[model samples]
Target chain A: AQSVTQPDIHITVSEGASLELRCNYSYGATPYLFWYVQSPGQGLQLLLKYFSGDTLVQGIKGFEAEFKRSQSSFNLRKPSVHWSDAAEYFCAVGSAEGYSTLTFGKGTMLLVSP
Target chain B: EAGVTQFPSHSVIEKGQTVTLRCDPISGHDNLYWYRRVMGKEIKFLLHFVKESKQDESGMPNNRFLAERTGGTYSTLKVQPAELEDSGVYFCASSQGYGETQYFGPGTRLLVL
Candidate 1:
């Protein structure tokens, strides 16, 4: 079985401040990792994904995540956050076989302040 | 292109009543999935459909839950004799193919009183 863990339940950051959200996963082999963001009353939007290759992957909305195999972590980061970035973020892990379902983390609620 | 769409954005029903949720996937998508978030719990997978066939349903909670995808265009999930624990947000997602990135719907928030 696969599982994902997000240590932070909520985080607050000031506008123009750098932000990082922690995510860890337990899987047998190399897993496909993803980060998604959801605003109130909206569906989740994919931020970024890590399949293979470069450890640092760029995503939409100036978001990026680094895959650390040694720590089993895929942490999302942004150089600077805007007030509009406040939302719920989820980290998920899936199998490379393609048919396996995704296992998601509990999600971290982000609060951006001015 | 239009994303996955779900109908009846919100639903409220008694514990013993029944509710049906609908999902219309993106055109040409071959994979559709159902997931739910209960209270503070993580989003959990309920089932996966490849076209009109159910590929996986191991995550379904019980027999009270039934899902059908007729003709492979859209899908419906019916919950009968709903329990209080069933109050949560149900989301539908679709992908162009297996292992591809999934596009999610706005979700239906079900509240059982």
Candidate 2:
């Protein structure tokens, strides 16, 4: 069984400040990783996903994440966050086999302050 | 194309009552899934439907919850004798195929009082 751990429950970043949300996963083999964001009253939107090839994957909204096998981590990062970036972010892990059944972390709520 | 849509964005029912949630996945999507998020908890998978057949239902909490996807189009989840513990947000997601990126719905916020 695979699982995701997001140490931070909530993160507050000032507007125009950089942001980093940590995520770690426990899986037996190579895992497919993803980042999703959900704004108030909105559906979960895919930020980015790492399947194969490049270790660094860029996503929509100027977000990027890197897959570090040694660290078992796929942390989401943004050079500068805006007030509109306030939302809840989730880190999920999946496998090529039945990866559709994703294992998600508890999620980290990002708050952008003025 | 329309993203996955769930009916009754919010549902409030008393304990022991019954509630049914509906999900309409994107057209041409072959995989549909159900997930739930309890207050302050992680979103957990409830089941997966591959077309009209249930591919995996290992995460279903109990028999009080029943899910069906007939004709391989839309899906429904019914909770009979709902309990307080059942209060949560139920989300529906769809994917084109195996290992594909899943598109999620806005979710139905179910509150059992």
Model 2 residue B69 CA deviation (Å) reads 0.4
Clashing pairs in 1: none
lDDT of 2 by residue, B16-108 (tens): 999999999999999999999999999999999999999999999999999999999999999999999999999999999978998899999
How well is each residue in B8-86 modelled by candidate 1, as lDDT tens digits?
9999999999999999999999899999999999999999999999999999999999999999999999999999999
The CAPRI quality class of candidate 2 comes to: high
User: What is each candidate's DockQ, to 2 decimals?
Assistant: 0.83, 0.84
Interface RMSD of 2: 1.2
Clash statistics: count for each candidate: 0, 0
Clashing residue pairs for model 2: none
Compare the candidates by DockQ and give the number of the best one.
Answer: 2
**What is the TM-score of each predicted model, taking all chains together?**
0.99, 0.99
**Candidate 2 C-alpha lDDT tens digits along A1-114:** 899999999999999999999999999988999999999999898999999999999999999999999999999999999999999999999896557599999999999999
Consecutive 10-residue window with the lowest summed lDDT within model 1 chain B = B97-106
Report the error of model 1 at residue A32, Å: 0.5
Q: In order, what lDDT does every prediction score? A: 0.95, 0.96
